[model samples]
Target: MTTEPTAADAVGPEQEAVETALVETVVASFDHCPDPRLKEIMVSLTRHLHAFIRNVRLTEQEWAAGIDFLTEAGHITDDVRQEFILLSDTLGASMQTVNVNNVAYADATEATVFGPFFVEDSPRVELGGDVSFGAPGEPCWVEGQVTDTAGKPLAGARIEVWEADEDGLYDVQRDAGRRAARGHLFSDENGEYRFWGLTPTPYPIPDDGPVGKMLAAVGRSPLRTSHLHFMVSHPGARTLVTHIFPEGDPIMWKDSVFGVKESLIKRFEHQPAGTPTPDGRQLKTAWRRVRFDIVLAPAGA
Candidate 1:
């Protein structure tokens, strides 16, 4: 005994009731979805979206423009960059996502958003090697240890590191002949890793695109808080993605990336010794030093 479709369903009336029905249809679709994580995300997203539509009384014209803007954002992606990540960074979504997952930072390196610029297989260098590649900036010696919560040296941990140049740009963003300011290093038996590079400098986010326009509309600067990037991982340990924001950086307290945590902010010590290079050339009038430790969670926990 099948019943006929009602007039409300057949007419597909373009009214508020129709909008409500559309929203209900979307909500009903989630009930049949299987993946717990995906279901959670989609359900929450749909709820918030419906609320936004109701609250703002969003019009078809506005939504069409929003879709077009997103399509344009997609057109901006390339091998070395991602516009959507730029959108997330500009909107503070990246930081929010990281913060939700990293509830505690006790003796642990704070996880930060891995921006689209991170390129793997960065030149592998030895301890005390300089990846600065002659860029102009304050010389810095970064020394750090990778360990477990129990303080055991994380032997053979792969330390993936990258940083922008003195002028605030990554190698992927420029055409430097040499591998500019990026490398990978393995921690030693003592769970120690060291590298020589310029101290991090504050720089702007990609603001020339729609993401940048959005930030400008919101009266925000696109600058990232000054910091260095690290991806430290070991066997049977959690891989850590984090930043070492410079102490006393104006933006340190308000990192645009939301990568800042009390433990990850490191002080740069000014060395008056003016250490000489291997060839005896005076490195700089004032060199900086930073020491920090990273702790990882047990694997598969």
Candidate 2:
């Protein structure tokens, strides 16, 4: 006796042909796009998206849930908080983009995620000045030199820095009109710079939203490793955005945004409370120090 066809068996060449035809139709719709790059991207995106749907055999309910998740992500985003960036970071898209754009050059500092907290028009600071600006954290003396990939000094390069406090909170996360633990300084004629910043500390990404829920659902931690953020820019060189992870951070390998690189990890030396600071500032509490030499690749290299 012959058996009747089941649902799985019924989904054969006819269904596949229909699905493939749909993808082709969508891709063809962009054929008239005037911009070549846009047309290429849209065509590829349509093909990949259709392929994903087919591979998963996505259910209507699952598609609707994804739409809801993105909608909530948009709702939670604001001037200070960027939920979409959080989503991209957690999904590793941000790092992938960084890798694509930041090709490696000899001894050039590796790039990483540009977290959502950076602000425009940060207060400018003199060399050796304090960036902490009264943010609550253990004192940290940070010194560095900026150079080109060829080892030529890059004087006057603007180094923008920011980080969370000892309590793992950025200045923007606290009361409005408050700014601390962040500032910018220009490298001196010798390509050297120094500043007082808070000791690096591990912090959770702002997770009171959809991104947090997704991480929890996937059994993933939202904690980033202890780090300090830096954005170095100079004329005729590619701008560098990166983080320096403390060498001993327990979660350095498990950073929520995958921002840590072995090359970016540096030692933070501890100094006794009574030890004289490099610039002769007296402190009643122990402080840490770190040195990070930055090298920038030539633009468009």
Candidate 3:
């Protein structure tokens, strides 16, 4: 059949040329940016973004929907909630950024997403003090040591820890002016630190927002594995933000944020009721315990 080509069929090469030119034009627009780093970022972003659009053959309707999604995400964000971070975490962008910035050094602990839940000015607890702050969950004894990559103990390291309660909610998610299941403490002279925390339980990342809707549309689960959060920092060392997942957690392989690493998994040993705690705090209910020895890479490593 000899039929004349339609306008759409004839637009291939010319359309691609126009798109490439637009990408270059947008990229060049950042050349005058005073900040060298900002210029590099903008130029690269323009190229990748334009390539994504072209590769997907994105439709106007799809583009509009994406804008609407981001708008909702922004509209719902507040001091306690960060929809944009959730979007990034779910898309694995946050983890990739962490990987790039936290290059592996000699035995330095692997880094993971700095989840949006971390808050500043968390109450300070002494070594061996309770960080649970009366949050609801089985008692957990978390003990660890902070050391340099060379195995030298690093005393006076500030260790910040936080976790959700049994009901899968952080203190920030509750009524305003509430705090629980989070605190900061310093390592002792021996570089040893210990505190009471809730037994980490698997929970869905806040799934009631736009990010949740997107996950549902894609048939993805929003559940994070059982884990405890820690941020450790010391002089002349790279600050470490990571989570320790319990060994044998069924969902460990499917963490929604893709934060799991084999080295970060530790066994959560069970203690029978009436078992003497490390600090001799008598707890009538059975509790769990875990130890995490942290190694920090030197700054600029």
Candidate 4:
């Protein structure tokens, strides 16, 4: 016993009713939002999202499974790790989006995924100090410089480095003897920096999570090539988080993250020994030499 103007109702009431009900529901459900920007974002998101559903005829099964996967992802995360990042990595979304946005193809240092092992607040160590925790492996010296796109020396640039030991395991993964195979160093006035650490060996990501489950389902290995992770930053320059693989490593070109750029592959030259370091510290034995050159974008670029 609803009465409506015939002509007006034909073009308006039903259609208006449906849209009003949907948009109102969205606003009411998301009333917890505090920021105006977030409100706008949710509004537009719901509108376009509904349009997508109408266009795609999506299935409920797919949506339910997605929610289930994400729920399990949350269950896997802990204080020392993030399973969501691993999911992003396995789906190629992490590498596709983060590693591409600040890419440097022309004389600039290429970027890559900063994996889950990166911990903050690494100790500051002297140039060429051995980062090896008590275990002995190959003796190696890693030297590098941080510069800008124009090749100008960058002073006071902070280059933070961490890598797996020769056994392809990080300090956090092993026993008490595994304390500090990672540290941060600042480039001197001449833009030069160097450190003594075991050359990193290729290793695989954790194989106990859903990402690992999915990879196993697809017949893929989680192996990343032997490389060292560098997170370099300076005032006014775009921070660069990346890695360099040994050029001759068999898996260098097949890194699971697909982060390798040809220009970033370094070569390790085995040398007997060189002159005593300026600090006059002598190695217990002969060591290998690995050279790396890092290029950073201008600050605030």
Candidate 5:
């Protein structure tokens, strides 16, 4: 004799039909999208998003709260701030994208988030010149070279660098007409590049808005470890955006946005007081020195 059907096997056809129709309806709406890639993305997004909502058994109140949270994040964003990026970052979505895009390349400096503070049209500085603009922090000597995957120097490569001041504030975060802690320069004939910058210090990830509240609610802090940001580019090379964290930072392994990578950490050496500087800046105090070498992949790579 056959056993009676159990409750687990009692799924109704209507239930399955409703769930499948929900996804198919959303996906079909994107069928007329002009761009094939966009259509494909929308279809996948619709399916995954529906699946997520169903799997979590999301309530109407919870969905409304999520929308409100995102709306607040958008309202707080401005020219010098990016709350949406912070949301993506804290969720590990930024790092996930980086991992997918940055395939392993031997000896090449690893990439990190291009944090919200980068400003376009940064003042150009010559090699060995100071970009600090008298910003208050321990002076730092940053030197590096840009090379190809094969270890060949790429002279004249543009190198853009920026960092937060000792107080963890960027130029834009301060008063107007300030361009400190950020500059752009080019590699020399031997692929060498150098500039005077401030030693990076640990800073918070703009925790005065919605993103901060989200982090707090989830028991996560908004502090990022001390680090310097760099963008290197050459005519035939892929533009590289990354950061170098100073070794021994208290939060080095606990960056709020998950931007740190083991290969990107560098030991910053402290020079003795009154040591002669390379660029002849006439500083009368001790300073920090960081050496970073970059390798760029071919544009098509």
Candidate 6:
């Protein structure tokens, strides 16, 4: 004869107890954290993370693989390369962060991903000077102005610019001592600025790493559309991080990084050889030109 089950045995605690223990234990770990913000973030993250694990019934093998992938991404990151940022960009997390930080203003320049390529202290170029630094590409003239939301010029505002060469590589990807096709300049008294740069071209994000393999596994391409990156800032205004895409770039609408904004797309006009530049420098070959005026919102808005 067998004994009948008791109420405690019939109402098993395995499933519910385990999940409650996991979430409570993790959340409690942050209760003594000195920083209130950190403590709150930790508790919320723990809750969501535990919920996600329970929802997916995540297997140990899958968890191990994810850990390995993130480890590999960290292993490949270095001074000039940032695999983590690449991962964030391809996953749309970076864009989401940008959206949160950049609230809309009255016709202010839209913000986009601040990718992994920016180099501080880039060469300072004079107005109308060439930033191509001998990188191979068709000559292009970039003219723009920095203005407030009210359309008043912001003279002396800094305009930082960088872009990949025609060969789809940045200076940081090349020789250590060589800097090319990236620079910063101050606006003129009238808030006007101009510089010569290489025509933008589509390029693949560093795809020899884990993030690239993950993208490939998901049938995603790593190509970013042809565009020029700009960071415009004035003392009391919100700095704008944005890009201007060449109008006809095939991948603009489907940028792998989800960085394209309709307002940021500008038509690049092709000028045949023998055309004169804005500063009266005559071109030797066919070139392209695009004008992009920036409107900055008040800082801390």
Where model 3 places Cα greater than 4 Å from the true spot, the runs are 1-11
Candidate 4 worst ten-residue window by lDDT: 3-12
- Writing each residue's lDDT as its tens digit, candidate 6 over 41-141 gives 88888888877776667789999999999999999999899999999999999999999999998989999999999989699999999999999898899
lDDT tens digits, residues 1-301, model 4? 9775543334367865775688679767777888989888888888777666544545699779768878888998886658888777767777888665785545778788888887786778877676665544676688888888888888888888888877777777675234667888889887888888776678888778777877888898888888888899988788888888876888876777777878788887765665454346675666667788888876545
28-108: candidate 2 lDDT, tens digit per residue: 999899999999999999998987778778899999999999999999998888999999999999999999999998889
> Per-residue alpha-carbon lDDT of model 1 for 1-301, expressed as tens digits?
9977643444344676877888878988989788989988997899889878766767799999899889989988777669999888766798788777766644666688887778766788897777776666787888878899888898889888888887888877786344767788888999988888888989887778888777777787778888888888888876787888888888775655566777778898777656654334466477788987889876653
Give TM-scores for every candidate, taking all chains together and pairing residue i with residue i: 0.86, 0.96, 0.95, 0.77, 0.93, 0.93
lDDT sort, best first? 2, 3, 6, 5, 1, 4
The pairs that clash in candidate 5 are none
Runs in model 6 lying further than 4 Å from the true structure: 1-14
Which candidate wins on TM-score? 2
Candidate 1 error regions (>4 Å): 1-18, 30-37, 103-106, 176-178, 273-284
Error of 2 at 172 (Å): 1.0
Clashing pairs for predicted structure model 1, backbone only? 205-222
Higher TM-score: candidate 1 or 4?
1
Q: Which model is ahead, 1 or 3, in terms of TM-score?
A: 3
Candidate 2 Cα misplacement greater than 4 A, ranges: 1-11
Per-residue error (Å), model 5, residue 9: 12
Instruction: For candidate 6, list the clashing residue pairs, or say none.
Output: none
Which candidate model has the greater lDDT, 1 or 3? 3
